[model samples]
Target: MSELYDDFKSIVLNKTPLIDVRAPVEFKKGAFLNSVNLPIMNDEERHEVGICYKNRGNAKAIELGHSLVSGYIKEQRIQAWSDFIDANPDALLYCFRGGQRSKISQEWLAERGKEIVRLKGGYKAFRSYLLRELEESTLHFKPIILGGRTGSGKTIELKKMSNAIDLEGLANHRGSSFGQKITPQTSQINFENNLTYELIQKLHDGFEHLVLEDEGRHIGNVFMPESFISLMAEAPLVILETPIEHRIEITLNEYVIEAQKMYECAGFENVLEAWQESIQSAMNRIKRRLGNQKHSEVCNIFEDAVQEQKKNGSYDKYRDWVEYLLREYYDPMYDYQIQKRSEKIVFRGNASEVHEYIKSVTLFSGRLK
Candidate 1:
């Protein structure tokens, strides 16, 4: 069992197949990386058991749980377990707390002379291990921060670099309110697992330099790990600069098409409502600062610019407006947080130039490092 325990940890680190015996809702909320849920109790059954535990007692809850799983359901669950064992002979299995449920399931399998290893402390244990690793792991690679203004093609450059860790891309966000993503973001736990996997991959590949886009502590709804952020703040930076027209073109490619598609899917009125709602607080701040007429004019200009961008396929008119909002709202806030962080600025005139510079530096240093 001790040897098997070590083997289980190795398999988890390697992201091998495993069975999670928690309820589906718990599994969906969060679980070990690459684990599949083979629930001991279905949603309603679990809820009923919980209610029984609260209303009655532990013994009554157990009795009700047994009553809920009749002959056919019990048979079905056993068959599922049998099928899983047949499919993965050495698979790791775990439940919520390494308690009666997991023990019962293991005993059931053992009666048939099948050997199944249970996680020592189950999901709770694994969660603790993961949290500790995230907090303490000595990440090897130095981040090459991709710094730029809102529309300056930093994300695209990171994508083009191919040796980059795109935090925003993985988070399915553009890193701002206006930076809504094309795809829905993953749960925060899932994002952390994904980020950890990417980081491990980079370290294992023996890469010494990793390019990454500069982002705030929170990208959309997901907050980055503090350890990684501290590392990023201390690493070298390359500040990209592109002409407003080029930046707008890049922004159009990255966001406009998707934004338009989302608007179309959501309908104009729905999108307008959402956009206005998202910007309302910021608009109020602007109103307080600039007064009613000026605030109204700026809002009108912003809406008109967006309409023009949609109609003309050019976001040039909104460039200054976007810059204004970023400088006034986003930059100052981010600066307040990371003002004294060490950085190196590398400016490029256009996307092509940015891409070229990154590729050249990465390729040249690849051999040396």
Candidate 2:
């Protein structure tokens, strides 16, 4: 009767103001875009009412709840509603499930002759709509995966592209232990929601190419949705190549200075122990590959390289050690993955050249074909 469908869709598109009628804790956990929490029941009251419903019955709980909220409190709520109306005359309100709470709130507002719209199915309906839209949108826009070994600057190149979706950026992680960021990572659910939102924005914008960094299923604590992952594997790819020196420079620029400072500030004794434990098996393989004397030398070299990185302002010395690790560990794994992938190696050059080449290609062609 209130043009609920049209109003809800407009709000979903962020064309209308959203007012959430759930408690603060529920809102903190998650909420729809642009929605602000304005609770009808305070935390303690909600808990008490819920407990009464469980112990006594619904009728008694309702009676007790009404008794707890005095006439003065109701007047205060009306005043709050007046304030909200003054601020947002055409606001849309929703509760958890479009149940008694939202209906009551809507009726109360309407009694004051205020124009307000109630979400038909409330938060649950909004969540279901987002999930369905995400699923449907993935089928329409294909992704172009960017693959390379660690430190290849694939992520940086992806950012340079006019049309790109950064899963790692959305997750607030760089896809590895070494990929830590300044800000705390989002909850996995939030990450998925953000990714879905980004996908929708990109698809609706009518971008011909959607360039994304090559990532495994998980980026630290957050895992990409299976729909996006399957879409990634099925899409074409553009692989960039850079020399070991260039790769090491990029990796060191990203990780070493920050990691060193973090280690110094936090004390790396624990980190050193953890690092030793995590890479012990891999180090053993490296040790066996080289004879005892050379293995000893390699260990000294590795330690010296780390020490040098700590002392020198530059990261050039660490290149050899990182390259050795990549050759021994990361390269073989990447090679195996590349063999299985149906990717096109578009450009193979140093970091600068590769960036330039990608720019030219995308600018001239107007897409990554």
For residues 117-172, write the lDDT of model 1, one tens digit per residue: 88877777766666766665446666777777667777766766656888887787
Cα lDDT, model 1, residue 305: 73
Candidate 1 residue-pair clash tally: 1
Global lDDT of model 1: 0.69
State the weakest 10-residue window (summed lDDT) of model 2.
272-281
Model 1's TM-score against the true structure: 0.71
The runs of at least 3 residues in candidate 1 whose Cα sits more than 4 Å from the true structure, single-residue gaps closed, are 1-14, 17-19, 32-38, 51-60, 71-92, 98-120, 181-185, 253-255, 263-295, 305-369
Query: Model 2: how far is 38 from its true place, Å?
Result: 5.4
Each candidate structure's TM-score, on Cα atoms with residue i matched to residue i, is 0.71, 0.68
The superposed Cα distance between candidate 2 and the true structure at residue 309, in angstroms, equals 8.1
lDDT agreement with native, every candidate: 0.69, 0.69
